[model samples]
Target: MTSPASSKRPLWIVAATLLLGAAALWGGSRLVWSAQQRDGGVRGMLLETQTGAQHSGALVPLAVLAVAGVAGAVATGGWPRRVLGVVLAVAGLWACWIAVDGVSFSGFPPGAPVWQMFLGRALTLLAGILVLLGGLIATKRAGAMPRLGARYAAPSVKKTARDPDTELWEALSEGEDPTDSA
Candidate 1:
């Protein structure tokens, strides 16, 4: 028998995964853009700083996360989905760490002011945490998908027609009031 809740699980997972992916993309693009705004360009400004390297490394993990999210949206069950979920979660954690470190490192220069550095770091940290949590939830939902899919994948139950309407009609025919305000 397919329970209504179980049947809806796949749709929910797909929707959640897609939403997470879209959010990550938006946040990531904004982070990169902000860094570019500070440095003037995406490719030329980051070779001299530790934060640059960390931020650069974030791209790969972000790619992995995007791919995994897309995959989860497209395919909700099986081992591939499980593997992707784990990868997405790990990537999310790594991204968070990089953001935190980058934010801290940005303030340690002779040119950069302390307030601006701290503010950038705080924003990065907040975004990182959001991405991390979203990825983690995506992972958890992926884990639940297989169980839900398996449960609902079972053969459907053929219910007998012992419906309330039929019973009511039979009661009325027998001179008994079916709707006696009971």
Candidate 2:
């Protein structure tokens, strides 16, 4: 018999997966396109002198990731979804680190644009938060985990594994014994 909890499990899992897909497909891709525009040619020259846009091609992967992330979310339940979520979360954290790296780690000269720095950092942080949240939400709704200790609980020794004599007696008691010497 299927319990109500069991029946509703698939729906919750699908909803969470789809919501995650929408966020990645819409928001993540937009951020990438903006970064790319700031990277190509004469603007690239201005960006060259700037640490924030130094290697702007990073945006390409961002777009790819957006598509991939959405596709992964839509696939629903299993290790693939879990792994993709972790990857998304990690990528977000890396972006956040990149944004902040110039502040103390880059050792670049002191003329980096204050506004650009903040924007990059803010975007990365936001992505990290969203990815982590998506991963967690999907995991919660999946409910693939086993209940209580039912999986490991000992089987009834009186049934399938019953002693031959006991089985004979039970069969005799039930008047269905075919193996009885009598």
What lDDT does the true structure give each of the candidates? Answer: 0.52, 0.49
Using all chains and alpha carbons, the TM-scores for the candidates as numbered come to 0.46, 0.45
- What is the clash count of model 1? 0
Residue-wise C-alpha lDDT for candidate 2, range 1-182, written one tens digit per residue: 77868755644543454344435433432342121113456545333333333434453365357456655655544565567666765655555555455443343334444445445555555655555555565455434523234444555664652687877776665568556567
Q: In candidate 2, residue 84 scores what lDDT? A: 65
Q: Choose the strongest candidate by lDDT.
A: 1
Candidate 1 Cα misplacement greater than 4 A, ranges: 1-54, 60-64, 105-127, 138-182
The C-alpha local distance difference test score for the whole of candidate 1 amounts to 0.52
Q: Give each prediction's root-mean-square deviation over alpha carbons.
A: 10.5, 10.9
Best by TM-score: 1
Error of 2 at 54 (Å): 3.1
